[model samples]
Structures are given as C-alpha cells and as structure tokens.
Target: MKNVSADAINALKAQCRGEVLLRDDAGYEAARQIWNGMFDRLPGIIVRCVGTGDVIKAVNFGRDHELLISVKGGGHNSAGNAVCDDGLMIDLSLMRRVNVDPKKKTLRVDGGALLGDMDDESQLYGLAVSGGGIISHTGVGGLTLGGGFGWISRKHGLAIDNLISAEVVTSDGKLLTASAGENPELFWGLRGGGGNFGIVTSFVFKCVAIGPEVYSGLIVKKFEDAKEYIKFHRDYVRTLPDDMTVWMVVRHAPPLPFLPNEVHGKMVVVVPFVWLGNEAEGKAFIKPIQEATPSHGEAFGMNPWVGWQSGFDGLVGHGARNYWKSHHIKGLSDDCIDKIIAFGDTMPSPECEIFIPHMEGAPSHVPADETAFSYRETPFVLNIHTRWQNPSDDKRCIAWARDFHAATEPFAKGVYVNFLSEEGEGRVKEAYTEAVWERLVQVKQKYDPQNLFRMNQNIKP
Candidate 1:
C-alpha cells in the first residue's frame, strides 16, 4: 500500500468540514476500526466527516488520487466492507443529527446516525420510521440501503420502505436528492441495493406514531425443549398480526440479574416479541404465542423503546468476531425446524445464536418490483449468526454455521444480502434474481460506472 500523499492530506484538511487522519496520525488506529473484530484493514486515510460537504470533499479526493473508497456509517458490517486496506474511508459517525417535524410526521436524519439515535428522537414524539433490530446502534444508511428488518418491519415495512427521500453524492462528485418523484430509478436502487450507488448523506423518512411504551421482552425455554418449542414457534408465528414481531433464538443466557443463577450457562430458546399497538390488543395477540408451550422461564411486559433496544446490547456489540449465514425461506418446514434446533442445541459459544425472523406482512405487501429487494415473497429469514470472542474458536464456529446451513438449505429460498459476507460473486448473484441483478447492474453503471462504491456487496458497473 502506498503512503497517503501529503498534498492530498493537506487539501482534505483545508476543504473538508471533518477531521482527516492519515495512517501515521494519532487517532488513525481508532478511526480505521470497524464493528466486526475479525477484520484487520489499514486504510491510508480516515476522514471523520462532519457533514455532507465533508463527504463530498473526501470522495473527490479519493477519486482524484485513484484511491479505493469505502463509506462507514455505523461500522457494523459483518463483512467489514465499511473500511478497506489502503483506501479512503468517509466515516460518518460525527455527522449524527436528527430533525423531526412532528406535525409533518417526518424525520430528517444525518447519514451517520444509528437506528438507536433515530428511534430515540422519533419515539419522543411517538413517531418512528421502520428500523432494524431494537439495537439502536445500527446506522440508518447501512440498514435502510440494505433493507432493514426488525420489530416494526411487519407493520411499517423495511427501513427503506419508510424512506421518503435521500441526499446522495454520486461518483462524479455531484450531490443530488433522490426520492419517489426525483431521480426515481436511483431511489428504487437505494431501497435494497446496498451502497453500490453512492454515498448517502441524509435521509428523510415518513414516520408513524408508535409507543413511548410497548409490550416487548423475552420468553426463555430449556434447550431440551428446543425441538417442540421451535416447531411450535414456526407454525404459530405466521398467525401473528402485523403489529407483533418475534424472533426465535437459541443461545446461553447472560448473567442478567433477572435471569436465574442456575440457568446462566445453560442452553436456552429465547423467543423475543414486540407488540406495537394498544396494550389490551397487544396482550391478546401475544397470548396465543405465550400459550404455545410451557416455558421454564418467561419475561414479558411493557418497556420504553430505548430499554428494549439496549436490553440485549450486552450480548451483541462491536469488537466481537461475527460470521453470518442467512437464508430466506418460503416456508419453515419441519425438517428446517429440526436442523435449527439441533444446531442450537450444540452452539459452540455463548455468543453464537440462531435467528429466524418472520418476513411477510408489510415488507411483502409492497410489490416485488417496487424495490430492488428480492425474496420479498419469502416468509422467513433464518440466520446462523456465528459470533465469538476467541479467534482460536473461529473455525469451529464457522464449521457449525456451514453445517447448520447445509442441513437447512433444502428448505430455504435465497439469502438476505444484508446478512451476507464475502461469499463471492456467485452467492451475491444468488441473493437476487437474474432480472433484479441485471437491473441493479444497469443502475450501478449509470450512477457509478467506475464502481467507486465497489467496497460494499458490490454490483459491478
């Protein structure tokens, strides 16, 4: 890797509204860091961009110097695609800001803001755009562009589904606003197409009034009950209303005060549910799910959105090795349930878990052509999230994930790109159909012919 040009560094310092750190700079190590602990890249420059103009200057600098470019919004990509070796990283973390127009029922958020930041701001007004995992730390840009799905997904749709508009800087260094009525094709591509198009600077979303308080918590069952409970969860989840969302997980419980001491290291099935409506109806909707089987332990009730988001933060966070295998399923077959439970029963580490999210309701209601996101027809997404702290255990965890996926592939439809890693071009192509792939390539050619944004789950120009 070549050393960063002193002249380019000087220009960045002069023109950008952000801090520029060369590889030899004091804060270089920290600025180049990403969420996935497995990746170790050394970027020549990391620009802690303060605003959209700063992003433009950094991009232009990269282009002028023929430096490969990567955009870091939340730095949480399991693939570690947000930064690159010997490239220019436009880090947006400093640009965190949210502007809410409560009367207008809309929110304009800075590109760097995480889902948590957006949720906190909007929830204060009893408003939210569909966002990903109650985990508030997921960045809006990465999640939205990759078609975010979480508790509110079945009701409000993908994070991109609620996106009203986005301000983007293209490869040519021109900033433009893309929305339904303006630069419509680019807007369609951004919905689920990852970051192949450009650097999204700001996003305006149509927010819906939700809860300052809601029904959400975990129901833990013994690992021995995984077989029966998982089968029941698969069958019963489909019957849930759009207002309720749930994910079935298999992992050892952390030493939470609420968790019993004896069960701290025991394998367990954690079924987390969130009901987004009136308390009475929410309770009624979840009652059938709660009654599906006897639980060894259960924790459920109303809680603030922030509390809910941060509840599991201790278990999953930055600096843990993350390897993900995800597949979208049209139906959760009996065999699929058996394989998932079997894998969960032998989880290699406490951080390792299986996530199966139902994906019908609002996300599927939008026409398949409405966005670049394919597999909307799929009913469920099964993710074998192999996470651990020890590098020596990486191979074992990866082996378990691969084996688990092999056993369940017969029942799966395709993979979710957002949950993907460096599975190569064939797997990337398989994430979408030939038609969707062709159109995405065309859009990539139009907006980024040189493939300036090629660091993501790239769609070649």
Candidate 2:
C-alpha cells in the first residue's frame, strides 16, 4: 500500500463526516469489494462519502496526497475501475438519497443512488427517466456518465439526453453545477464521456410519464431455431414502434418457474422486451415474434415497472467474475447472425450470454455532436457478457468472449464505453468519434489537467 503519514490520515478523518477506512478497519474488506470479483484490489484508503461535503473532502485529500484515485458509485462496472491496487478510493455507496418532483416530472439523484432507488421513487410519482439499464442495482452516476440506455431508450432517448444538470466536483475541489445553460461544454462532455472530467455528486434528470405498470416479458426459443429466428427478429424489429423495444439474448436457460426443469441448463435464445404503451397494442406488436418461432416457454403481460426492472436481478447478482466485449453495429447481417449463433452454441459457461439490444430511435434522432455519445445512429449494440464464478475458469471465459468479439468485429461500427473491460486506449477511442474525443480532451485539459480522475475509461488531457 502507498504510505501515508498517520497524522495526515487522522486529519482527513477529522475533516470528513463519513467513514475513513484503512486496510485493517472493520468494514475495509467489504468496502473495497466491487461488483466484478475478477478485480481483487486493495486500496490504501477508502472514504465512504455520505454526502457532497464528504465527497469534496475526499477529492481534496486525494489530490493533495497525489494518490491514484478511483471513484466507486454503485461499483457495478465490468472493468472494476472503482478500485485500485494502492490508491485512494472514494466510495459513494452510502450517499443514496433520491428525491422526486411529481409536479415538475423531474428527479434529483445522489451520486451513489442505484437504478432501483431512482426507479422506486420515480414510479411512486408515475414518472421515470429514460436511460437506466435493466439491472436495478446499476449506479445512476456511472451509467449516466457513460450514456445510459435501457427499456425506454427507444422512446425517450439516452440518459444523457434527459439529464437536466449535474453537480460536479473537479480536480481542484471546486463544486460546479453543469447544465445546458451553465457550463454547456462540460455538460456535453459529461453525457457519454465516461468519468474522465470529474466526480459528479448528484444528477437532475427530466422524467417522462411511463408507468405505474407496463407490458413486458421474456420468450425463450430453442437453440436449434436461433439462426432463423434471429434473422427474422432483425428484420421484424425494424418495423416496431418507438414505444416498444425487444432485445435478443442467447444463453443457457436459468431455472425459472416458467421454463421446464428439463430445459433449465439448455442453450436457448431469449427475447425480452418492454412496451411503454397500451397493453392491447403492446400485445399486437409482440405477436409476430411469438408466431414466427416456436417458443420452448414464454411469459408476457402487465408487470409493475419496478418489478420488471428488478426481474433479472437474480441472474446478475454480484460477486461473479465478469468480462465484457461489445460492439455497435448498424445492422445485423446474415454472417453476424451465424457467428452469434455459433458462439451461443459453445458458450464457455452457463452464465455467459450474447446480448443484442436494438438501439436507434429517440437517441438516433439527435445530432452526433449534440452530446459526447456520438453513436446516435447505430441500430444495434452487441454485447458479449462472459460471466462465471471461479478463478479457475477465468482464462476459458475471457478467451471465449475475446474470440467471439473478434469473429464479429468486421460488422462493428464502434462500441459502448460502459460495456468495455480493460481493453486499452484504442478500444477507448472507439467509444467516441474523433471530433467528440477532441472536444472531450479540451474539457479534460480545462477541468482535470493533471488527470487525477483517470481510473475510468479515460479521456486524457
């Protein structure tokens, strides 16, 4: 661990209201553990920030000490950038306070608030932002910084699109609120810039009226029918309305009550979707896919928005080794479909899956330069989610994901920064267009010239 004088540590502890944990501290081990188990790092110090004041203190301390700093929001990143081997880790897990304004149709979320926190509060007011991912435990801070997307993206646009403003603490420890009207340039960079500029303490987002409940569910298809079904799915989804989104995933069936026990461990193609409109129309829109391929098992109907958001939580629970390789494709061609099916057939682990989410609706309508998230016109995002529980299986799981990624690279236009693992700088560049990257560099130079916050998918000054 990097050496810090006891006096200095005590001074930090005195200044901050939150916990300052050392390696031997009671909760140190638990505080340092992030979502991805593959990263077993031991940070020299962990500041469990309880509020913006605590965050500012931690930031100032890390900068003064010239320590490598990693910021942990929900700690759900696949790359495990939330922790470092020997550095200062600012843990925001304790600051999860979410406030909703039903009249204004807006919500203000703390940096540490999880998607579930936001969803639970917003749904109470019959309002929701468009961009949190399917998993409810994802951090609002990291996900929004990386240009979040999920069930409602097609209708409402990316998380960045709905972002009204943010309260940011820069490298110099100056707290500033960025919005379209205030610090517009920095606001643009924050949209999809991944955590390069600074630490965001809280976020203000515009919410759309979605649901107390909506129509959504999963349909499982046998692997034998994946090839043809996927092709038809690709063509069929193009005709879908903006209010509906259907994503395809290939993986071994999990032991859910809906599926027979015999098919539990078998490879299958699962089509999961959410419709923000009327139940009758949603059913009519989803009818073609159900009729196109024979399903092994299926479940579809009206579910509480919160319930559907957390439905897959069991499958993606924390404490697993994860390696993700992703690509942004304009369209799913025949060759790409074949490669995806082949990889699905030989999945290294039951937890591994090939996720193809259709992208392109409200987000696509925005100009590329409008926000740092430049892949606005891309039609599909292909993510190779390689997951397993054992250190012994790491090599095989990672190799499988890498090979599958390489096989599908020819059809890729770019990639999503959030889905990236520790793939180097070149892959990072792929996340942004050249023009947007240059602009981000300018913002970084102005706010973080010393690159104090370089732990994330970095955009260096």
Best by TM-score: 2
Clashes of 2: 0
Question: Mind giving the per-residue lDDT tens digits that candidate 2 earns over 1-461?
Answer: 54579999999999899999999899999999998889999999999998889989999999988899999999999999999978999999998898999998899999989999999999998888898889998999899999999999999999999999999999999999999999998999999998888899999999999778889999998899988899999999888988999999999999978999999999999999998888899899988989988999999898999999999999888999999999998789999999998888889999988899999799999888889997888989999999999999999998999999999999999889999999988999999899988999999999999999999999889
Per-residue lDDT over 1-461 for candidate 1, one digit per residue giving the tens place of the 0 to 100 score: 36456775887799877788877789889988888999999988889999888988888888878899989999887989998998888899888899999999999999888988888888889987875556777788898898888788898888888889999999999999999999999999998899999999999989888778788887777777677777777778888888888888777876756677898888887888988877788778777766777666777788987678767776778899989888887687778777777787788888888877788899888898889888887888888889999999989998988898888889988788888888887888878878889999999999999998889998998
Screening candidate 1 with a backbone cut-off below 3 angstroms (N, C-alpha, C), the clashing residue pairs are: 116-136
Cα-based RMSD of candidate 2: 0.9
Q: What is the lDDT of candidate 1?
A: 0.85
Instruction: Tell me the TM-score of each prediction against the true structure.
Output: 0.97, 0.99
Candidate 2, residue 445: Cα displacement in angstroms equals: 0.5
- Evaluate residue 290 in candidate 2 and report its C-alpha lDDT on the 0 to 100 scale: 92
Q: Which portions of model 1 miss their true places by more than 4 Å?
A: 1-4
The lDDT per prediction is 0.85, 0.92
